[model samples]
Target: MTTSNFHGAVGTKAKPVTSQFQFGPWTLTAVKSHILESEGIARQRFEGELELPQVPEMIFADNVLRLQHVAGFGLEFNALDALKLVDAHNDPLKVAVAQAWKEARADCEHINEVVKPFDWTFTTEYKGTLIGKDGVQLKVEPTDERIDLEKLKVREKIHFYEDILLFDDELSDNGSSIMNVKIRVMPTSFFILLRQFMRVDNVVVRVLDTRLYHEAEKDFILREHSYKESKVQDIQGPPHIVTDPNQVAQLLPIKRETFEKLIFPSSSISQKEADAIR
Candidate 1:
């Protein structure tokens, strides 16, 4: 694991710190910044055109994972991009939450106040932002490739590891919503998991995961996205599990899944140019 650090400026005028590691042909970087301020939140709300979650101030807008290959292919995971996936259309989940809130606060004087509709649960299915080098066209094609769990289970020396929290909220104490990304590098391969977990009290529990895996010296990477969810009442577990997204995620049933492969070019040439040369 090759490690390095750098500093930059962000909101609150605080210096943002970055940590990175270099492996076979890839560079993995994690950037962490202070929580968003009122000014920052207002700007983001306007720019993103979305109603954010409670405690939006906790969001680390600059926190991100940047994984790049020497060939200029890369992927980025960040809070702003993930929050954009929250329901803009009045989905069932949003409606249900609104109704629940109204019913729970029927006696309150402000119960009838008009409120904008958004995915109160803050669920998102974001995988990652794919990046290609200048003049290169990179696309992830559906493939049969899958990550080898058995191999990952084996004990091996870990070269580098990082867990980055992008954003999190308590859903105004109705439940919780959190998004984070974790990565681990080993001698022969690396794995990344970008996850979004949400729980709406007496409503539902959901988890969306995007996994990326690559072996040393490999010319391609494997990517998988899985979504799982279960009704709050239907989820039978210890009392504590309901509050822990990681624990509840194990009990939720899989609702959808997909796999894809990203192939790297042999040289700096674009795929179209390479084909022409061939």
Candidate 2:
């Protein structure tokens, strides 16, 4: 494993710090930057939204976790793209939160004559952004391939590991919204997990997780996404458990799950070629 650290200039003034790790034919990079200033072009990009969290700056475009393969394929997790999954229209969750806010603030001095609706909980189902070496976007196709959890359970030396935060918001004291990614590289394989966890106090708890696993010498990466959610009242556990996404994730049933693969074009060989080489 080879590791390096540096600062990359995103703009004239913003120097995002970056850490990179190289293992086998893959390179993993994480970029982190300070909160976006309220008056910048970056902040303007999020304008026109019905409502943003108090710490909206944390979702600035520059913060990301990226993995690239020598074969010209890459995957990235970024806050900007993840937040796009937040519903702009009036979803059931949004409507419920709005009503709760209205009732909670019924006696407030400045109640608006009309209320705008949005997903107050900031729930999202973004997996990861896939792209090719030429900057063209790629799509993950459904596949039978799956990550071997038993293999991962075996004790192995970790070559590299990193946890990268994309964004986090307190949701105006209603609850919390957070998106983060973690990657671990072993001698024989690498694994990544991108998680988006949202908690709307007394309303709902939601989690969306994306897992990617790639074994050394393999021509493809297996990707899995699982979405789980449950109403706060329906979850049966210690009250404090609700505050921890990791613990609560086990309680919530899986609402949806998907498996896909990202194949490296350069690594693929025809059967005839393989036979000839043999």
Candidate 3:
């Protein structure tokens, strides 16, 4: 489809993609495929260098494809670098340079394999029954209200590598209105290891609480705006002031002021005015 048609159709689906460099094979592949589809996406994917979980859906889709390369981190030890390091080590001033280069290369290789997946599965350990206040066992009828997650304290144990998410339901013996559900989550440790390639560790857990996660994010953004405003006040005092040329220069980083009254007052001294004052 054309760019306008594609953008209109995709909506938020065409939003930017960020990378942590540590993506599993499937995740990387999906991300790369998304990038290949559009020049804007490709540019964003490479240029953003954003961490994981920042855009949860993008990470999820990309995690399905599995990419194999780090975006900007070029090899520090190509043949040329190797030769230069070897020559430098030959000098009396840099005898350890060669060994240092080898260590650095090894470390980079280790980082490269971080996003690869391994056995990422866990089993649901708890055995229990769900019921309503009416003394009806949930095993008989799976009604949303009877065993609904809203009232139920259901916990889930997720294992990423094994590709299985285990759902656990734990409740109190009492016939209380609320079902005490406990979600015991465990994903393959290797999945975390894969994130290490991108210097990340909490990838799977990061995506677990989507709703609360966004709420917290919104709160953070608001707080950040307040903090920024406070800082601006501290640095610049009250905003309304004479539109002196110097003050206008200081406010350049902010958007240009449309109204002369809203902006700083002019302080430019014309040649005739300066001569008259002198």
Provide C-alpha RMSD values for all models, in order: 5.3, 5.3, 29.3
For 1-278, candidate 1 gives per-residue lDDT tens digits of 56656555564476667888877557789887777665565555644555443324367877889987666778899887887777754445754565765565455433355355456566788998887668553467999878998988899998888889988877656777889999999987889999888888887888999989988766788999999988888988876787886788889999999999977765644434433543
lDDT winner, 1 or 2: 1
True lDDT of residue 56, candidate 2 = 41
| Tens digits of lDDT, candidate 3, 1-278 | 00111223265356423222212111211111131222366535632452211111111222121212111111010111111211211222222332332344354433244343211111111122111233321122211221123422333343222121111111111100110111111221111111000001111110011010001001110000000001223334344321222342233233111110111112323324433553
* Every model's TM-score: 0.82, 0.81, 0.14
Candidate 3 all-Cα RMSD: 29.3
Residue 7 accuracy (lDDT) in model 1: 58
Strongest candidate by lDDT: 1
Q: Which ten residues in a row have the lowest lDDT in candidate 1?
A: 48-57
User: How much is 250 displaced in model 2, in angstroms?
Assistant: 0.6
Query: How far off is residue 170 in model 2, in Å?
Result: 1.3
Off by over 4 Å in 3: 1-48, 51-278
Number of the top-ranking candidate, with TM-score as the measure: 1
Which of candidates 2 and 3 is the stronger one according to TM-score? 2
Quantify all predictions' global Cα lDDT against the true fold.
0.75, 0.74, 0.20
The worst-scoring run of ten residues by lDDT in candidate 2 lies at 48-57
TM-score of decoy 2: 0.81
